[model samples]
Target: MKRRVAITGVGLIDPLNESINNFFARTIRGESSIRYFASKGDPVPVSIPAVYCADFKGDDLLGKHRTISMDRFSQMGLVAAFDAWTNAGFNVHDRSHKPNAGVSWGTALGGTRIYEQGLREMWINGRERLPPLSVVMGMNNACSSHIAIQLGLGNSSLTYSVACSSASAAIGEAYKRIRNGEANIMVTGGSDTPLIYGVIRAWDGMRVLSPGNEENSPSACRPFDKSRSGLVLGEGAAALVLEDWDHAILRGARILAELAGYGANCDHVNLVKPDSSGQAAAISLALEDAGIPPKDVGYVNAHGTATIEGDPSEIEALRSVFGRQAKELAVSSTKSTHGHLMGASGAVEAVITVLCLKNSIVPPTANLKDIDTSCEGVRHIRIGDSNKSDLKAAISNSFAFGGSNAVLVFKST
Candidate 1:
């Protein structure tokens, strides 16, 4: 028998370090956290616009002993996971074995910062060896393993590293686990710390890193606009607690939203460029999985990286799927405000989408001035616009570099 999955809790580490309520409120207000980042006194200095959680002190949150051997990405993921567990009404102090719960996480460049530091120590500082815990901390599965260990989840501990689609794919798989009765609860999300020197240099080489001065850095990520540039890299994490509907009901958990459907597929046409046909197929499959029609999906949290090719391609996919209904569909890209969180983007955007359904208010695409003609099929939610639409369902889109696409359909419970 197929069971239903419900989202009982959500958590994240963003630039504000604020509560989830404040984060959602600020996002709806179209506020941007991006700032100018310039590396000084380095062998190769790079300047760009990015979002960093300057106030996040993992040691303070997770304590020194617990975070002693974890990498920055692992620390961020564990913090978010613990917050989600507590928010879901689970006792963090009760670390008893739970054979019915598990963890699924994702990251594109897990522990890249740690590896970079080790390389610098060996090549530049003449160090003979890295820290003893470097291998354990730098593993991509470290975060998920830590979560399972701390919570005593014994069903499964899995990790996915599919670039930008990592988190969405993780969340989707967790939903499937609960839907298929494989587990009663699952902690799922993704995190990435991509603001490192080498990471930025590589993205800069690709010419996809948007440029900005100190004054305009906040508006550097302008998606679907005539003057839109490219993506701004950000560092953060987001997590969700998925539970079986009956289990949540038995426990009297406050259900946030229903994770109704998930569809994932490979474009297979290009390594970096997006194909609209593949994207449309994924969207159609997700809607079909949810037993929902195109006209019923009220809003879309677009994976709008503001690149020249990505924005129009996403809009074209929507046009092909929804046809005339696309004209009235509300669409916005929260990346305009939060910047892109790389592998973690999908999880953070999914949280925002769930909030939209709960509050019946859609957030506008921050800094969107004029929509490009190719991206004008839908009702573009722009800054300063009233967004209090009564929405029943919404979808979050995540398209990654290796032609991986994942779409999540969520409905108000």
Candidate 2:
């Protein structure tokens, strides 16, 4: 109960791969999933394209409501979780364990696709009329609930809806549960499908999204760069099998990485913009939790959304927390290649950080023509391709729309 937690298995379904192993292998080869193709027909201005999971048909992975009603985001979470559980070599209902298995899914906006669709049907059909599956499918917790039901995970099943940091927070909470003797295993992650027109329109209202970037599609996300304009939206889901370190070893499970510490802070200052001081505090708190010095951190997976306010604020946050070490740190944003997956951003990027440690490499920032003079001293890997090396420890930051900041520190297993 006093020790650490380890990632036993991880499954990802995004623009990169339908499976986790495939995604990591491809990433090591310096591949990207960003594309300019449009789903609605006509030449739509799409930038910061991401690796997106393809469509799913009726299947057991979709569970009981396979043919009925479900959103793309929830469906993807289920599929990814299915693979994650199998990869971890455990089943939710196995009599070998009790109360040890749990489910926690996070999302910024859950099942918006289902929500908008149901709303349209209701407006067209009237309250007297009905869409049979509206109630169960459109709810914000639907994704978590569905997976819980199919897996028989009982009351421990829950959802955290904290925008971009949602997934990392979910992972952090699960880590605590396992370490405190509450549970032995938990499946935690996030899902989102914001590529839909309705979803895009919601983000566009904030005026932080890119209109278009014709020349740099994959590299449209120029994090911490002077040429950085704004963030490009992307979507996907990722799930991790988190288990107690000893239990995973006893079960002969493969360890991906060790989750040493996690810290979450809220600005409570603004609804949209983050408080840089608050964000900096989160990282310092995480480092304290890990019992490690800031200089020991080898790399940082920055939030780096490339927004007008986000990049500089985070850079300053780093400077406040790590001081001179922040200047020499190898920081990069995967958002440049994958775009921001909203709810799933933190979870998926956490997986990326772990794998980068396991594989002894760092994925490139994708697009960095000119560095911002303000961020000059901070070491951001401005290369356009993957670079290989031994990574000892890494920090991942995810800041969301509601001024929620989540930071996690991972060490080699």
Candidate 3:
């Protein structure tokens, strides 16, 4: 028999809020966190509106000693992971429980801020100045490494870097590990702090970052709307504590929801553009893994980045998977409010999906005033929140730039 996985605890550090309850409450209120930031002597021509964790003080959460060696991204991960560890009722200082736990973190453009700072120091200062811990802090695996060391997880520590799908992939792999009995518990999530000057400039060159209307900066990310422009970059982290169902039951843990299935695939098409067929296959595969039929999914947390191409591609994929019933599914994209968190999008959205299942309230697609005709058929939860107490299962979709697609199925417990 396959071991079941239960989501016992969740942690979030985002532009909207840090705690799960606060984040969900703010999200359901249809508020957007995107704001304008003036360029700091960068080559970028204009200021852009982006989502940022304004009040996050890593030093306050991790302490001066622990924060000294970590970059902003890693610090966010450590803080979120710590929140999850405590929420799960585990003693972080107890080394005896460490052997049974592990960490799987996902990130895209890890520690880019440190790299950018290093480059500035070398080029502008005309000196070979660099931080002593720069190499370690700039590594892609640094967040996972720090999480493992800080939490004393000894079973395994892995980091995934699959563009936007990174976090979902990490969580899926963690679920498999628990199911295969490799570990009893896994702390899984993703983090990315990509709002720095260099990263934003690079993204701006790609023409994917939203060019906000000077009048209304917060309403820039208009996902599924006819006037949708592009995604607004955001930075944050979210973590989930996944435990074997039997172990959780024996320990009398309260189960938030069950991670029932996971599916991952690639488009094999474009480097940046998404393919409907590839996304459809991943959704179908996830349903198959969960032994669920298409009609049973009451909600879909779409990977709607508000890009002209992305929104249509995702809708097309949903149409393929649900067929005529696609029109009946309640779908929305929280990215409309939170902005895109790059690698951390999947993990943060997963937490939101679980909260929706637990609370029976679906967050709206903010700024979706006029739905694009292409996305018309789907029953999108737009503008305001919707209450659906009978929702049984929901799927969170994450399709990355490299054609990597990951789908996760969550069932109400």
Candidate 4:
């Protein structure tokens, strides 16, 4: 029999709200975190407005690790993991759970901030690079190892980088390990703070970003809308404490939700685009693994990044997977509120979706004036305001740059 894995605790550090409760409350109330991106002169090309964390104190969580030449991504990961560990009522530094726990984190880019800094130093010193810690601290696995060392897991500490699906894949892989009796507990999630100039320039090069009025704030991202342009850049981290069902109950832990199923696939046909049929297969594979019929799903947390290709492609995938039942399902994109958090997007959204299911409240897709025509069957919650309630379950989708797709099925514990 397959082992059961449950989400004992979850935490989010996003642009809208840092705490989970505050974040969901504000999100459900039709709030938008999208704000004007200050024109900080060159390097930060094209006053590309973005949504950033309102109250992030990475320095406070940095401590000894802060001086280790870590970058912004590592800092976000450490802070988020620490907060999630504490929220789950587990003292990460405590010996009680350290030995049995592990750290498997994910991110699109690790230490982008430090990489930029390192490159600058190299130029200033005429390419005579110094400090062996440059690559070590700037490495992508730095965040995962940081969490592992800080908490002293002394076990498997792996970092998976699959573009946007990095965190979702991390959580799914973590679940697989625990379900297979690898560990009793695992601290898994993702973080990314690569709002650096290089990343944006790279994104712009693809023409995937919305060319609308960056000054208007909301013009950047508008999922499921007729005038939807492109996804807005967002930064933050979200972490979850994944524990065995029996282990959580033994410790009297507050069981939030059961991670019933996880599925992933790659559209091998394309590098940056998805094959229509293959994308749908990924969603179906997830439901099949969950052992739940399509009719069982009440809500869906879409990977709606508001891109011209992303939103409709995902809608089609859902329709193909869920068939006629898709029409009755309530599907909302939390990205409408939080923007695209890149690496951390899927994990944070899963938390939001799980909370919505627990409270029976579905977060609406804000700023969606008109739902697109091609994407039918999926019900969009365009409520004017919101409140807290419980729900049965929530489905989160994460597709990355290279057609890397991940889907997760979650239910209340």
Most TM-score-accurate candidate: 1
lDDT of each: 0.93, 0.78, 0.90, 0.80
Model 2: clashing residue pairs? Answer: 15-51, 15-52
Q: In model 3, which runs have C-alpha deviations exceeding 4 angstroms?
A: 16-18, 41-46
The global Cα lDDT (0 to 1) of model 2 is 0.78
Write down the worst ten-residue block by lDDT for model 4: 385-394
Candidate 4 lDDT, 20-51, residue by residue in tens: 78888887876878786643444445656577
lDDT of 1 by residue, 201-274 (tens): 99999999888999999999999999998999999999999999999999899999999999999999999999
lDDT of 4 at 128: 74
Off by over 4 Å in 4: 16-18, 39-44, 64-67, 124-127, 212-215, 385-390
TM-scores of the candidates are 0.99, 0.91, 0.97, 0.94
Worst 10 residues of 3 by lDDT: 37-46
RMSD in Å for all candidates: 0.9, 2.8, 1.4, 2.1
On a 0 to 1 TM-score scale, where does candidate 3 land against the true structure? Answer: 0.97
Best by lDDT: 1
Candidate 2 lDDT tens digits, 1-413: 37789998887775744566677665554455666635453135433354455554425556554636666777888877877887778774564453567888888888777766666567655755556676666677787876776676653787898988999988888888887878888888988888776667667777787655445566667887888878888778889888889999987989989999989989888988878998998998888888889988888899988887888888889889888777778888888877888989888888999888888887767676687876665777756543666777999998877788889999997
Clash pairs, candidate 1, are: none
lDDT of 3: 0.90
Deviation in Å, model 1, residue 196 alpha carbon:
0.2
Clashing pairs in 4: 37-49, 357-391, 358-390, 359-389, 359-390, 360-389, 360-390, 360-391
